[model samples]
Target: MQMTVSEVLARFVSETDFSALNNDNVVAAKTTISDCIGCTVAGSATEVGRIVRRVAQSSGGEGKATIIGGVSGASAQAAALVNGAAAHALDYDDILWSLYGHPSVTVLSATLAVAETEGASGRDLIQAYAIGVEIIGKLGRAVNPQHYEHGWHATASIGVIGAAAACAKLMRLTEKQIAMALGIAASQASGVRRNFGTMTKPLHAGNAARAGVFSAELARDGFTSSLVAFEGEFGWARTLNARTVPDSDGLQVMLGKPWELTEPGIVLKRYPSCGGTHCALDAMIAIKDQHNLKLEEIERIDCDASPFAHKVLLYPRPVSGLEGKFSMEFCLAVAAIEGSAALRHFDEAWINDPRVQALLPRISFNPRADLEPAISADAVPAEVTVFARGQAFSQKVLVPSGDPRNPMSTADRRAKFMDCADGILETDVAEKLFNDWERLDQVAQLDELLSPLRPQN
Candidate 1:
């Protein structure tokens, strides 16, 4: 008899061992986790971070985990909720290409919180993370450009299930209990593209992370749910309107054969903005650097990308910093004029600056359906042309930097971490944290690593 989708996954999750993970994959996981911590710590001071922290504080239950960069503790679920939000608050966390979403914030936030709560070791957390990555990465392949095109936010829609899987692994639930956790997670999956560029966007990550912990804890206590919720008539795949419903047979065959975490790998961000805008930013920045181009020398900027990028980068004339992050026009213009679109650049004052406003209208975007077939969904292929100095200079980017094919160096990763960790942590503490993360697999407890991260009064 053929096994149900949940049964196949339950066996895979239950049977997988940390020792089975490749050394390179384990290194990738540590790098991704380190990047996530930097983002979460830096994001703690953001407006959205404060709001969630406030909510988590007021609704306090048993305090079992620490909120990164915050002074207090909360229940594992609540900490996951707030930390998940904080991690992606600046839209700067690591992204998995296959998942087509910010996977680390959603998966790590829940896994870390639960690890601390269960007194699980660092090795246990790593194994749970690998499990989550396997589930979500495969789901992304099964569902994709179609699922994303349907206006569903995969980070929340699919991430909740991955988070649950990670939490369930840490809890050591039986296969039946794991299936129940997945079913419970399916009901909670939600988030839409319509909410992009708003505070609610990051909230999706938090909610997904929280739901994972919630469902796993309930399932550990013998809570019941459908074993085949992924493929049932009213299940996640059908209900979410997946472009092509995933095949259980195919999914079962693919599990653990080639691990997803290392196959597509995670793409670290060079810019602290939406992934949609990176290709354009890369092309524009390259052109600017090559010619040492100045703003006045440019008459118009033309950018070409796939329709998916055109749609995600919806804002042509962004009025706020948050909106600026998603605007191709704003990001390219800033890169061309300012030479960098660093964290300090995406503020309301900078977004509404006279120079930025003047440059926005000069940039025009066009759809390039031709480039869609060759690249991954998260890989935005962009060609940017600048009509400057009465001459046209163009750069075409097939895969932006930080992509697996074009990976960031160890120095690049460290520089980014320090830039983010500045002001949030003392220099020595930040350096030590980064060093500690490099050897994270050997650490016994996550709390020992995270405890010093609490904001000093």
Candidate 2:
């Protein structure tokens, strides 16, 4: 019997077993949740986040869910959008570089909000997260490499599917219900590369998270959609991207084996810009510190990277903060000038500063097969160089900082949370969340953790 997307999604949720946790999936689960908390804390006070919260509140979405960055309450849909954006606002959150370019942010944000609303236990929250990471991350591989190449935001598109699955699981829907949830979510999936460098970019994440929860909620109440939504002639695969599709047994492959969250793994980013440009950022920063190259002595800079990365990051002369995140050349230029790039470097003033703007004209990048390392199907290695005092110095980085292979230390991760929490949560509140995250299973109420998510400033 053919199923609907929601049906399969509901089934995936019903099948999840918390106690049988795979060791690798558990770690990925922790890291991803840790990553989302850090990003949300950092983005709580941003202009974009505040406005969106107001908009959601104005919509009269009264419910039990605590909006991560909201002062009071909102419907599940409202919380998902706000928290989802916060999870990736700084771009320093952990990554799934080999998969959806970005994940966990949208997946976990929705799960967290819904979990809180459902009055779910910590163990249950953890289980929902695992199912989400699996379904979404695997779907990334399914429509992958090309899904992104087709200009679809995998984090938003593929992520919606996972978010719905996670919500369904948390709600304990039947297999038939999951298929319907997935089907509804499939139709709701959407995002475009064109929105990069704008507030809409992060909004994609928030919207998808919200959409996933809504899809699952509707499914649980007898709503239905097409389960084979992905395999049809004009379905997700055909209409969104026909260039490449997962094998015929795509869904069957690894349904409960070789978890995608563990195998391909996740990337933890060191910088706050686009993950696409981080390899180049790492290479540039390394070469600068290594050779002690001062910007005043530099004449020009050049870089090489994956064509897809270059396509998204082609904004050499970025005009806004959002554009800055997508501009490899611009980000590297600023890093060279400031000696390092961090959360503050993404401010509009820095992005539009005359020096950064002037330097933009001197940098360029193109496709380079030599930069490839096969980190996975989508590894993006980068090479960056600066011409200074008539001498050329350059460096190459195969991957960015946050990959599971080159994971950030616990201290580094904590520090990241603090950095993002600045001006948002009280110091004590931030500290408490990190210390208590692992023990979330022990707590019956999520309010204590969620209460501090609102901006303290």
lDDT of each: 0.86, 0.76
* Alpha carbon RMSD to native, model 2: 2.3
Clashes of 2: 31
lDDT of 1 by residue, 1-457 (tens): 8877887787788888898898988988888988998899888779989999888878868767888867545798888999999998889887887778999889999999999888988889888998898899888887776777789888989999999999999999998899889889989999998888888989999999999999999999989889778888998898887766667788878876688778888899999999878888889998999999998898999999877787687688888788888898899889988877799888898888888889888899889888673334658788999998889999999888888789999898888889888887889988888889878899987776887788666
Candidate 1 Cα lDDT to native:
0.86
The TM-score that candidate 1 achieves is: 0.98
In model 1, where is the ten-residue run with the lowest total lDDT? 371-380
Candidate 2: regions farther than 4 A off: 1-10, 242-248, 372-378, 455-457
Expressed as tens digits, the lDDT of each residue in 117-222 for candidate 2 is 8889777887887788777766666666677777888889888888988888777778887788888888998999788777887888999999999988998899
